[model samples]
Target: MIFNRKFGAPGLQRKKLAIISTYNENCGNASYTHVLKVAFSEIFDVDVIPLDLFLLQKPQPFINIHADAHIKSICAKLKNYDYVNIQFEAGLYGATAGAILRRMKWLIDAAPNLILTMHRVDVAETTSLIEAIGKSVRALRAGPLFHHFRNKEFSVLYHNIVLHCKEQSARKNVWIKVHAKREHRVIRDVFRFKNVIHYPLAFLNKEEQKKVKALPKADLAARFGLPQGSKLFGVFGYISNYKGIETAIKTVAQLPTDWHLVIAGSQHPQSIKAYKDVDPYLESILNLIANEDAERERKLAKLARVNHYLEKTEVVDERLTKPITDRIKFIGSLDDDDFVHVLRDIDAVVLPYIEVGQSMSGVIVLAMEAGGRVLGANNLSFAETRKYFGDTFERFDIGNHIELAQRLQAEPLEVEAARTAIFETYNIRNSVALQAQVFEGTYKNV
Candidate 1:
């Protein structure tokens, strides 16, 4: 009978919801789970089970991943819960689709009321005949009927996924939820999953919203060491390659000194692991990033050296070019309260991501909810955000430095108007309430 203050725990027992996630881990899905756990706590007696899906390891070097222990663990644990929700991302679970499927199949058998929320589904909007044929060939090779024949783990994954999806498609309680609309279309149209749930990703709790609105206008110059009265633009979350950080960096160099860029975060620990495990090709790309980051560091060091030399000589060396890289600053990662406070402080939040296999972005939702002007890449996720939230955001071509720069140079969004659209359209409570209600209906019918 422990009573929670923020969200009252009812005297009578509430329905149980077991959220299966790497709750202690740092990932976008984990963050989302934390938010949902808080938001939905009012309705259900919520509990979390740490499913260390991404921490999969092989029995031996270059041998197959020993996923059976995890499978058995999930099946046993989930049977006791009234309802189970899996914060699923295929890549986050296993190295390949087949590897992930093996884990999911266990859940499909164990919990009838299991709901899987997929974060990524790569179904290109259009395809060539050859591409279609190639996919079909792969599907046949990887399908559960033929998975045993495939030599490499990678080749069999997608095909087996299609087979597993088809098998689970007819299950009433086994709901496939996705965050974006286009992803919903792909599930329904491409995979022929008629029961796909187009659930909107929610962010910012009532307390966080109150905190954001009550945030005092702080001295940004002193706090983050930026110039006084500079119009601060920001990029949030972990620094990654496809995140288009280079474009943002280059774009910052072109902007006026008054238009400062504040990178209000660092690389997340889990993301560092994801970079290592997900793709071998990404290793070479990351080496290039390391080189680029080194170059930036050198510029900063050189700026210091040149400034020190000039202080004594009191004259510019004619051969040396003066550096104008002072405005770009990287404030290390902040906790949730500080993140909201910092997000509330910024003039705009820029998402300059290149086209990639993301179903949706949690940042866009959070930024919109925080009542700031959002500038996002013109892709499926951002486009959906614009379509739903109206002029709360603007779009630029993905990785297009000139276009991104042009958008930044444009007049800033009116604060009151942006706040209005965001609060009115997509607050945390409304989205969560809708989800809980719909989820209850599913429970009843199931």
Candidate 2:
């Protein structure tokens, strides 16, 4: 009995596909899996077997019998499917790197044809050994082991996993899907994987694209209880330190009085509930907002005193009439539909992220696709992803609040052409076709 099956024509028998990923969780993996399921379902009979994060992610001080059994049971079910796709991320499978690798090997053995989408492949950082050691020592002095050793461990685990994939691909049909071109080269050239696929995270399907209607900026401002004429700059996704939201806030502080900020997402649940620790990131952002507000008040008060002394008519600034804190709005976490709508509604999406070697960002892609102007830090991830976006996605120096402020005030680049280019290149149909061709042995990999 042949476990691997090729695709027939439309209306013919469909190949059975089992996707092992987080389905219902509130993570990027779940969102990616949903879109993957939707795209692949057009060609294959898709079943999304949710990876139980709650059970599998619990810290295993010793040999975790339950996690081992869980993996075995899940693998046992994969025998029924023609192909299995696992959304491979380090943290999703196990609490530790060793455990994740063991489970991954087990899953690989169970399926005849496996397609693994590696979300983050940190094979190595381009840091000097001395620099890395110094940084690691500083990180160790600060707190958790992960602060310094994360990249070291991640690189080792990723290398081992790719080596395992290269081995397995030799025996049976196995494919590794990566998000970036650099990652593709690393896996194919360095790891020597024959079957490798690379594509940006394309979430907005044709239908989703049609449904993405922009709520007018005026209406969004009204809904968020801001001035109708406010020039709203937005920073999206979870409220995390690495997002560089403080830079966005500082940018807004430096901008004209009409400028305001809308922080769309709340603190990530994991950041809050992970160690039962206080959310310092959130507190720091709030404190920055307060400081900016006080600074604004001081400026206005000085202006008022100057006007009084000169006996000149006090020209009140209409925008600063309200408290500065009011200008910075936090609407909390939004649903999928609301997210797209706000993406379109904002004046410009500000991504002041500090460099952390992120491979891709769904927010950046979605913002451009939704016809919103984007301003991101000139990080490597943004630069690489900018190939798909063209000149429409404006970039600033990483962590430069003044640069961000100046760019935000400047006229945005024309996005209609960029939008057209992105849609033509990365639409849902193209993505589905490429993956289907891979499955059918029709697409050639370089």
In order of appearance, the predictions have TM-scores of 0.75, 0.89
* lDDT by residue for model 2 (348-417), tens: 8989888777788888888877777889899888887866666778889988998888888888887786
What tens-digit string does per-residue lDDT give for candidate 1 at 394-429? Answer: 788887878877888888666566566456545666
Model 2 scores worst on lDDT over the 10 consecutive residues at 1-10
Model 2 score (lDDT):
0.79
Error of 1 at 399 (Å): 2.9
Candidate that scores best on TM-score? 2
| C-alpha RMSD values across all candidates | 7.9, 4.1
